[model samples]
Target: MDKIIIDTAQFQRTISRISHQIIEKHASFDDVVLVGIKRRGAEIAEMLQKRIFELANINLPLMALDITFYRDDLNQANADPIYAGVDNPIPIENKKVILIDDVLFTGRTIRAALDALLDRGRASKIELVIFIDRGHRELPIRADYVGKNIPTSRSETIQVRTEHYDGINQVALLQ
Candidate 1:
């Protein structure tokens, strides 16, 4: 069975709320970089970037971080070794990076993203922003900013559909 947890209106409100939270925490976005995980994460980052710009009138640097090797579904034995995504080579030395993602399940993806970030440059600090926190973390990682918390069982899955990918904006729970 599949159920819609969040609709389009809620999605817009969530992004606005999250944008306000980020602005509240930072007096200045000069050294702050918004790095979204590829695909959905990247799309959310763009949304936040636009929202922040509209609210604060200052544009923050945005980048998409692709963790092909970090994902369990794509990192199989017979998987392709090539990373097809474009490489974003922005120097993040001593900068505060706000890592964005769609969901927080196993912390392995975050760990792999950390590795990729370090390879780019030594960040002063890294804060996480997850659109959904669905529990069941395999590691100690946690999101600093969460749009929503939907506790899920191991047999279930949380899918966040966006206009960029699924032509809709909503959160769906599938079992």
Candidate 2:
């Protein structure tokens, strides 16, 4: 079941729409912080931040969160932990946090991120924003804002690529 549903232009448009919706729902970017999970999630978060800044002229804080060590699947005997460097050390306590991720397949990653965040400090509220929501969630997690909801089989994979890294923006379905 190989399919290329979302093209570059469509992907960009979807992202733009999501950004606008985020700004609208929040009323403003004030006190909002965009925190992206490592790898592609970080890139998506940065792109969203750029759009928000351009649209509202409000520069929201962008933070990177690396949960490599926090993942429940990784074991010390099988893999060595790698930290994807996060730039900000500002405490998230009492701040509105928006967790960004490229794809939401299993809910485990979000759980790990929440754990890591709690270790640092408490957030006033945490809302999830995902570019692609491929359903097969192991936990009860759901996205507050979703770019697209793609029904998928367990064997399928949803890939999200951004212009910042891949020189193009698109979402591809691979088996």
Candidate 3:
């Protein structure tokens, strides 16, 4: 069964709130860049980027990251070796990087993203931002900015769909 957790309006408001919080914390967007994990994360990053642009009138650098090989559980047997749509080599040195993603669960994906990000460039500070944070972290990683925190069991799954990718704007909890 799938149950809706967030509607379109709520999702937009969440993104807006997150944008305002980021601006409030950073105070300036001059040295901040948004780097999103590939797929859904990229969509959310773009949304946040546009929101920030509308609010602060600053066009922050945005980059999409693919961490295929960085994943630890992937098998090399039948998997494709090629990683498509990789990063464009954005300079993150001495900059604040806000990593965006759809959901934060086990923290493995974030770990892989961190490794992939480090391979590109070193940032002065790296913070995580997630639309949904479900609480079953295997690592110590935590989101600096969270849209919603839903305590979920290990068996449940959280899905965040955006119009940019999933053809809808909603968040759902699935069992």
Show where candidate 3 strays beyond 4 Å: 76-82
List, residue by residue over 1-175, the lDDT tens digit for candidate 1.
8899999999999999999999999988889999998889989999999999999997988899888876666746585666756345567999999999999998888998898888889999999999999999989999999999999999999999999999998999999
Weakest lDDT window of 10 consecutive positions for candidate 1: 79-88
Question: Each candidate's TM vs. the true structure?
Answer: 0.94, 0.93, 0.94
> Candidate 3: global Cα-lDDT?
0.91
lDDT of 3 by residue, 1-175 (tens): 9999999999999999999999899977778989989889988999999999999887889999998889887784486666865666588888899999999999999999999888878899999999999998899999999999999999999999989778998999999
Residue 17 of model 3 has an lDDT of: 99
Q: How accurate is candidate 1 locally (lDDT)?
A: 0.90
- Relative to the true structure, candidate 3 reaches a TM of 0.94
Q: Which ten residues in a row have the lowest lDDT in candidate 2?
A: 76-85
The candidates, ranked best first by TM-score, are: 3, 1, 2
Point out where model 2 deviates above 4 Å.
Answer: 76-78
lDDT of 2 by residue, 1-175 (tens): 6477789888878878888989888965567788998878888888889888888887889888898888898884466677866767557998899999999999999999899889878999999999999998899999999999999889888988777777778888999
lDDT by candidate, in order shown: 0.90, 0.86, 0.91
